[model samples]
Target: MDSEFENQCLEQEENEEYEETESSSVQEKNNDGETTKQLSPREVNTIFNSETEVCEYYRQYGLQNGSGIMIRNTRKIDGVNTYLTVACHRYGEPNQKVVDSLKPKPVVKTNCKARVCAKRMDEDNKWHVTQFDNKHDHDLSPSKAHRFRCNRKLTKHAKRSLNLYDEAGIPMNKSYNALVVEHGGHKNMPFSKKDCENYMREIRKLRLAKGDAVALQNYFNKAQSIDSHFYYSIDLDDENRIKNLFWADARCRATYKEFGDVVAFDTTYLTNKYDMPFAPFVGVNHHGQSILLGCGLVSNEDTITFVWLFRTWLTCMFGNPPNAIITDQDRAMQNAIEQVFPKARHRWCLWHIMKKIPEKLKGYKEYDSIKFQLQNVVYDSIDIDTFEIGWSSMISKFNLENNDWLNGLYEGRHRWIPCFVKDCFWAGMSTTQRSESMNAFFDGYVNAKTSLREFVEKYDNALKDKVEKEVNADTRSLSTTIPCVTPHAMEKQFQENYTNDKFKEFQKEIVNVKYCECMMLQSDEAIFNYQVEEIQYVGDSQTLRTVKYNVVFIKDMELEYEVKCECRLFEFRGIICRHIIKVLLFKQNVFTISSKYILKRWRKNVKRCHSRTKVTYSTWKDTEEKRMYEMVCDAFYRIVDLAAENLERCNHLVGTFKKLELEWDTNDKGCSTSIVTKPEYFVKILMVNVA
Candidate 1:
């Protein structure tokens, strides 16, 4: 019996040693592994089938450990979520509005090794956590995890407000603060700042300016829906990425008809994330305000891209090419303009032409004087022969014969010199270029990191402000008191016929009338020529430079007169020159100058002068009465178009309307003392009586 008991003890000792060795080896193999057994009966009954259900299971599982875990990666087969990897993250927690991408992800070096991957089985329509590595190197914190993990997901209302502010150009930080205040603070908020950032990125993507291709498609669709007259054309390369894009709004198209005669094209500034040069076709309005005619985005200012853009602009403006176009001295622009607008006088931007003078010539002696001389040669040169003589003499005097830059500039003189292109109408933009002002104007609208979507939106706002300014100027010109003018019929005619701003300009010339004198140089049956000279003396201080002008005039139908001047001020500035005004006064027409001499652009009736007035109403909210007033004005516009005929016909209609106005006033005056009724009743009764 004693021998059998000792043998049993030895057998039990051997079994214990074998069991301990097997357990240690099993643990050593599972550094990051979880249970390999089938789930318990309770867990098996709680198995998930769909992606939503499986995701819910992971959420619950994560919560049980006092930490929130999110889906770190997801995969699908045949467009169904068939697999997913989840992990616990510390920073992924949101005060509110956390994005899935911003959810904290686990790293290999971290103690939190919590992870679960689920896959759908083909044999059974069931989902299983095929791989779950639930081992951790650190302790889990529930309270801290609760701060990130949502007790409840974001509601639909909150999401709507989020998207609303996102589109309104509100910053994420401000939005988050507002949301935190509304949601009862960070501890109780549903998402974190990281979550909001992710949402913003998604918003950017939706605008189609982000990295997503699908989002770009959505942007075009939405833009068109908002502005039906909004037109956009895109050219893409083999990679299916945009190479060129052009767009124009209804207001731009309408403004172009009158102001598009001379356009300044500039594309030097980069105001987008894609580093694309933003090109704006800009023009000056009758109000002397800079107006946007159209805009484009191009990967490069190459000939090919420029060709597409110019063609697109023509298409937008109904193929009516501009009479004169100005742009910086970019070779690509030169090539494109020659092809697209073969007839349009292509002039190099004057600002860029002069900008290089300081950089290239400032190092020379008498830099300031040299710059002054150069500008005079460019701007003040009156005749081609005079410009040539001054240019040759200045070059020789400055010893710029060896300067390659001057040589290059001389070669391109026709493009930048005013005298060379004096015949071309530049619309008061001779001394101005598109670069300095364009860069300044766009700097307020966009920055280097602006996205494509943001740029498009900001452009409309900028354009809106410009148009509003123009409208206000027009209103002020028409409604405000007119400035007093000299009693001369010529000056008085100008004061009533021209806008207030233009009157100020004419006033300058009229004031200088006394500072000048004219004499008849020659006369003929067909024409009369005169020499006009300006003289100024300051009490023996210094005699100012004597300026002279040669003006020719002819009479047509007894009273009809025509004139041209050597100064070419009217040719370039789009206004009658002081020389021409001097000739008219010298010719003794003192009654009134021909209506043909008055430019319609400078006239107070420019808008009224044009018959068509189709208004593209803005989308801002307005009161009912204001909306009704706009609609009534719109109806009046239709009536004007219908009655668009000779001036006599329009005057006849106006006379008949005045008779009706008199009858209505007579009735209103008779009723003012007889009626004591509700305001609406009186309004209705008066209309009924008048009708």
Candidate 2:
């Protein structure tokens, strides 16, 4: 009657005469022929209705007495066990053969002579404990009794809770600690943390017995049935094992049509137990938030895998490749991008290249000066000629012509140097920071120990969070506005049109206009050249310096004007710079921004098709009922497609569905009445209508 089994009932007794004799005590003599003591009923003679009950009672008694119990022997008559003996776990000698094995283990058996013998009574068809011994040869550990394997168990409710925690990506240790705290302490808990972990491991093994590939396929199939826009592609090896996987939901595909011009791809994060690389294609949304366009898991980082992933993602997004792509300087990735996205302007991440300077040049005596000059040459160059001149000067000055790392970087300068790649629009990004940020966003949801099956579910949870954040930003943009800091109509125009986050970026340039001074240097019939001197703060010391940029203003036939600046800020970042604003607004008296400059991607009121596609994070168990539900949904989806072709058909289908729902509800409530019908009749009606 321990607390663990308070709700358990004993097996039914066949004879009523022996039921009242469930407990009895006996006296035993000591070795010296003196009466030792009177034993308790459990330690002397106890009657149980079943063999299992007898063994459980003896095990519980051993636990209370600070001893581990194990089944010693059993004698069966034909098929039924007629005699059984339960003994102390340390009641026997270790086998000499096993003790002398090559890989030896410490022996815990001490030949303790404590045991209980049970026999079946033919008259009552019940088991009775005929002999028992409560004495032990070794010291007992009452306080540590719960640590014995025979005493550890997890209840049904605890198992259910642990399964839920496992699905939510909670670590086993944390989940175990939560249970310990809930049960008051570790001693009060029924099982050890290791026991909980073993249970979880067994569950995972059962889930993966069919292989991770099948689990992934079933998950994708169910997801697509729930929402037809969910997309997934799996590449298999010759043995039909999963080699690579790519997935994108409806929201991701819809969002791509708007912000897929520039993408940042990276594969530095690993989230599954298989150690496969997690590659995420990330982009910047209208609110300057990092959005996931699509993602994949690859078994290898070679060119072939990259090609497969890229092509699969391209197909998912309706074959619309990004105009510009940014990634680290991986030669394999570079080759893959060239083969798959030939038209995409591939740029190396400048931050990634710049960060390697210390590691590559730290051995040099003048490493600080070399790094400083290299940064200046990479960042401060105004055009290609200036970059080449500064690069050559730095190499010659540092006597680094023979250095391999520097030479290799110089050969790839056009892919990373700002002055060389400024002509192409990169959405204000010079590195793969967006992809890295997206990876960091999932840190709280997944970890290195996550299984492939668990990772798929956690991925949905993380994406749902991202969607909710975007929706909240949209709501804020619609409900609130940021005030313009300048009197010029251009700042006000941006404030009215752009989202609040983008509007804040525009206001930054307007604020920096005070640091710029523009003066016309030359003039023609329809063209004017101006020199703009801008003050910039440099380094940690905030040293003040002035730099001059050339701005050209050209007037067209219809009085429309075009402005270009040597800085190329607008060309590279899609944002007009402070120097351009000074010349166009302060010098030329221009009032409003041009229509072409207002990117629809950043407009506040532009409706996105992806916003209507809901993202759900609910998980489904792999059961027969779930599979059947998916089949039913798939059939209904086909019917919906046919009905949606015309308004008349759609209305007719909706009316029929309503009538069916009403009849089902009515029938469900009339089950208690005399009038009852099988639900298959409704299915017959539905089948007739479909035919």
| Best model number under TM-score | 2
Estimated TM-score for each candidate: 0.64, 0.79
Off by over 4 Å in 1: 1-198, 209-214, 225-228, 430-434, 535-544, 586-591, 608-691
Report the C-alpha lDDT of model 2 over 1-691, residue by residue, as the tens digit.
4754643422222221122212255354644699744324374456888888877877766664567789999999899899999998888986566645688877768888888899998999988888887667776664566788889999865787797787666778899888988888877888988889899888877766688888789878888887788899999999989899999988899889989999999887664779788888988888888888989999999999999999999999999999999988899999999999999999988777877887899999999999999888887898899889999999999999999988998899888888889999888774736545766799878878778777777787788788889889999999998987777889989988888988888789889989999899999989999999999999999999998899999989998889999999888878888888898887888888788788887898998887877765454455664455455556677777777778877787778788877766786765442222333444455555654
Query: Per-residue CA lDDT of candidate 1, range 1-691, in tens?
Result: 9999999987876553332111211222222475432111122333466666666655654443455666777888889877776666532333443357567554423435566667777788787776666554455543344455443455554665676565455667888899999978787676777777777677666656544234445566566676677677877778777777778877788888888899989886674778788999988777566778889988887998899999999999999999999888899999999999999998887777777877899799788777877777776677888889888988898888998988888899998888787777776664464466667666565777777776776666666666667778888888985666567787888888877877777778877877778999999886899988977553356857677778898876686777888877777776777777877776646457777767887787766421243333334223454555445445555545645665755665566557656755776766453322223443343334333
Predict model 1's lDDT versus the native. Answer: 0.70
